[model samples]
Target chain A: MIENELRPKVNEFEIQGTNFSDYQSPLFIAWQLNSICNLECLHCCEEAGEIMPNELNREEVMDFCQQIVDLNIPYVAISGGEPMMHPDFFKICEFFRSNGISLKVETNGLFINKEVAARFGKLGFRSVQISVDGASQDTFEKMRIKGNFKKVIEACKFLVEAGVNTEIVFVPTKFNIHETGKLIDMSYDMGIYGFYTGKIMQIGRAGQNWDILCPSAQEYEEFFKVLTEKEKQYAGKMKVYYYPYDVIEELKYRLEKPSASLLVIPNGKTKLIGPLPFVCGDLRKSKLSEIWNDYQKAWKKDEVISFTKQVIENPELLKEANKWREL
Target chain B: MEFQKHVKVRQEKFGAVVFETLREKIFVTNESGAQILSLLQAGKEPEAVTNELSSMYDGDPAVIKKDVDEVISTLQESGIIKN
Candidate 1:
């Protein structure tokens, strides 16, 4: 979460003739469609399990989509405790697609059967990233508790068969670092278009289990070496993307030029990413443009900068930041 | 003719990218194609587009008209513009 965790792939964006820097309104929106989920993942970023009482209703969601259309923002990446589980998931997808906004989905892939896959393909999603954290079923189930690895694999196969641009997302940690190569091979065999992996962030459920789940520096170094080899091996076959977090770089970027992206949680509030638990404004009460303006200014505030520094110095503060905060 | 309400045309450094929302498709065009799209987006007719191009470039009027007609046809076929 310390980085622009939901930044769309540069190559993919370029292919669509989208240059994020050129946009007036924030072009990329990382939307948490809901707070309810089917699985209790070990590193659940939102600590998402139960439904939030104030999650956006159908009308509100439609209004939000209208605001997006008004702003002419081109892309949105939908995630959640599980976005597919949201009752209006398909409707939301259809709204965005019909409005000419490109969309990408981040899901656990459990809900995607053949019929759902056909619907997804029909929706023409730019890409669908499915999380299959480990190379083996035991390792995967260890991270995504109660998740069936075979079902996820089957889901990927179905999505590919449906002609959807499918990719795999892996978050590496101490427990699953050894399976990196195997996971890549598995993804390639499934006809995945891309393989996106990142280092586990020190926030959310992951922050709670940092000691047990976070990989050692040496482990990351080893993993990157393997990743480098895999990139070369998979060149021209499957795109490989890895985002290693750098807190200092992220802090600078936030201070100077924050991403032209906003994180809209399930409760219709826009929250700052990482250990800064600051809410810019409530989307329910404000327009997207107003919230976006407040967001840009929030990064420049001394309170935000100092608090971010404090969090970096004392990682324990992240636990407090992970929860919803009024301001 | 006008670009569809759901269709958005964005000018990029290389050319222009046209988004057809109903179909969930993106189309890229070269410099001249981008000019043509911009004109169409501004509600220019095919004849007006040809006239504008005739004034902008040193090409023959007939050839420019032919090119405009071809570009307009492509845009219509792609559902980016409509009468």
Candidate 2:
């Protein structure tokens, strides 16, 4: 059904009255194929690398994909645990592509090899975002924990060579902030399309060791200045973006707000916002209009206001916001 | 009069409800409850809130007063609505 047909009609009593055009629905849907990943990063939000069995099965995922296609979402981002870890990762990609939904896979770049990269390219995937937290093995391995930096680099090469749009996301912590430039240069050399440098948000397991994971405002400013300067130097070659709410203003002009995006968790909970526990609505039961209406109401009631305000006030928080774009 | 901490009314698409995420609980209330919440946000006293609800809805002042008091008391016990 067309979104307009399903759009809820808001009347005067609506908390946010009718003139809510500025609010856009999610254009890209991020489906967490599985929460299990090969690498356990220090600041992993989805807590990937930890297997959560009893998640959505293949049939359920297919149904979810059909719903997404019905909704006419332009893009679907397959994330994890590690999407590759799912038994039907290839089938999932094929299903999404066959249904005319552009797929973007978020991975650690370990399982993605030359063959897999070529297959994804052949299947017409839109982009592949791989987290390369460090430029060197020492720092990269530290953040990714179980990830093989060499394998990640190899995956990058394969994806680039296969003509896949590759985006390298660097989650800067005290240990890897210094390697930001090197990471960018390395990613650019690998012929990647963009580099997203982000600060480690003190959420999830990363919150425990926040003293080391979270960067100070001053540190972020220095890192951002250096990175953006490099980004300018490499302008035509690759686009670079930064994260954390603090640096949004600096990168605001370059950000493109897509038309509609939605994130469906394994449990059938579809979220318009970030990967928070509060879902907009469950697609298994609620209609798209119901979800959109709920999201609008929540957004109006300041549920998302604090997070948006935090991003506005602190550019560093933009990093998380940027991550959502890829998701 | 004993007052509790701040109370916030989060109006979602399903309906206007009060919830505390930190506590991970939802407090469901009706339109009158939402009206009472609006008045409380303005720092209105129980009597004023009763008066406002009485005026807004087709209810008696005494009944409104008792209902508002009950809602406020429950909200207070739940640590959402405060004085």
Best DockQ goes to which candidate? 1
Q: How close is candidate 1 to the true structure, as a TM-score?
A: 0.79
Say which candidate scores most in lDDT: 1
Which ten residues in a row are the worst by lDDT in model 2 chain B?
Answer: B1-10
Model 1 alpha-carbon drift over 4 Å, by segment: A1-22, A325-327, B1-83
Runs in model 2 deviating more than 4 A are A1-25, A244-260, A302-327, B1-83
Q: Estimate each model's TM-score.
A: 0.79, 0.65
Task: State what share of the real interface contacts each candidate retains.
Answer: 0.00, 0.00
**Candidate 2: C-alpha lDDT:** 0.64
Span of ten consecutive residues with least summed lDDT in model 2 chain A: A7-16
Q: Tell me the lDDT of model 2 at A94.
A: 89
The DockQ values of the predictions, listed in order, are 0.08, 0.01
Model 2 lDDT tens row, A14-113: 2111223232333446677777766778888665566665676667777777766665554567887788878988887888778766577888888888
- Each model's total of backbone clashes: 0, 29
Winning candidate number (TM-score): 1
User: For model 1, how big is the CA root-mean-square deviation?
Assistant: 8.1
Per-residue accuracy of model 1 over A125-193 as CA lDDT, tens digit each: 878999989999999999998899999999999999999989899999887999999999989999999
